[model samples]
Target: MRWTVLPLLVLVPLGYVIISAQQSRESGESKQLEAAARHLTFGYYPSSLQQRIYQVPIPYGAAHVGYLETNSWSTSVLYVQFTTTAGGLDTFLAKVGTSRAALRSGSSEISRSQAREASWTFSGPGPWSGTSMHKNGDKPDHAISVDLHDPDAPTVYVVSTVNFRYGFRDS
Candidate 1:
């Protein structure tokens, strides 16, 4: 009876601690849900966690980096913007499975409905290169819009979306 009581006491505390840890982990993943409008964060470079989640690379010497995330019942979006060197820009584009030639000059490839979800405006464009990089039924689709007003430092805008339906669905 004594031994049974000791194991029960220790097991109860261990189970409680495990449950609490699981809750904290889930809560941390959902902090963005608190925002009703937009979950936008800007920095010089994306966090490692974000890089992993979004699978978007921040080229070396990237500046003016911005990351916007939106999630709802059916879709999750990640929009990233940054300014990097021309070579870096090319490398970045290639890594995302596209190239400079694929982008159209003086155009913004991001669809109007998609931009609205990120609370972004792709209008008032200059020398821009834009295109849809990749689309898969089960994987995230990526669209890129580049600002080439300053050829030396191109500002890249990319929208990566995980769509669960046929049409546009946002958070």
Candidate 2:
């Protein structure tokens, strides 16, 4: 009886330790999965120039620019902002407009909209693209907006990995 009781005491503690270690390992894996999902799905503000999403090349007679990526809970955005003279902004607009018109004529997937300051919005989807123009009320530079979204993401029980970059042509 004495021998049996001693062995039971050791066995119980050993079992407890094994269970605790397994729980710790599973908890760690769960945390890692959550982080990867956030990196794939979540987006934050693009406050630094180093965190760029893509670049756009202006057609005709304008300068090409690089875009910074940003997101909210439900949307993804690519944006470029630069300081230039009013004449430069006009040139930028004209070039972008010409490009959008070409895209529209070429593809039935494209659609257009109007934004403030004579900006244009064009949207299409193979990998989803949106274009627009903007100016902050106080800022000295005009902004160009383009965004992309994945058509198939997040249905659960399956994982998808998406990698993105832009092909920008020199103007």
Candidate 3:
């Protein structure tokens, strides 16, 4: 009886230690991924078009952008895109209307379209969510898209296309 009790105590402690280590490792990985996501989304934008094409005002801390992909070997990669509308659509709208009005109206339309697109794309096996939305009173609409996959396969793929109306207020 004495020997049995001593072995049980040792095994239980060992199991606890193993679990604690695993938890810490997972926590660290999560933090790293979050930082990666931020870096990816904040720097992505279409290079072909000049930034002036987007017209709405871009407020500080009011934008987000990123995407993630997983390959068949279970490896994953994340990409982020960022851009601001300074002279494009916003400038055009300011010619005819208040900046605030243009921003709010434009953002409302963009948000609606984004929500619809996200829903349609994720209706199947993949899952997605809109993590943030900032309506700049109708000048420029700011938003973020987040996606994830459980048991992601090596060949799993994900892509995000972001559209911005910069200079124009309506439309």
Error of 3 at 158 (Å): 22
**lDDT score, candidate 2:** 0.33
The model with the greater TM-score, 1 or 2, is 1
Best by TM-score: 1
Which 10 consecutive residues of model 1 have the lowest summed lDDT? 31-40
Name the candidate, 1 or 2, with the larger lDDT value: 1
Off by over 4 Å in 3: 38-103, 107-171
Ranking by lDDT: 1, 3, 2
TM-score of each: 0.70, 0.25, 0.28
Query: Each candidate's root-mean-square deviation in Å?
Result: 6.0, 17.2, 17.0
lDDT per residue (tens digit) for residues 1-171 in model 1: 999999999999999999999999888775644344364566535567666656687898898887777777888788888889999998988877778889988788899887776667766546777988556555577888888889898888888877777653333
Can you tell me which runs of candidate 2 are displaced by over 4 Å? 38-171
Residue-wise lDDT of candidate 3 within 1-171, one digit each (tens)?
A: 999999999999999999999999999996576444422333333222212222322323323433332222322222223222343223423432334333321112224443443332334343433322333423323333322233121011112222343432445
* Per-residue alpha-carbon lDDT of candidate 2 for residues 1-171, written as tens digits (9 for 90 to 100): 999999999999999999999999999996565434422222332223322222232222222232233334533334333333334434444643423232222222312221211132333333322233332232122223322232122000001111222222221
Q: How would you order the candidates by TM-score, starting with the best?
A: 1, 3, 2
lDDT, residue 155, candidate 1: 87
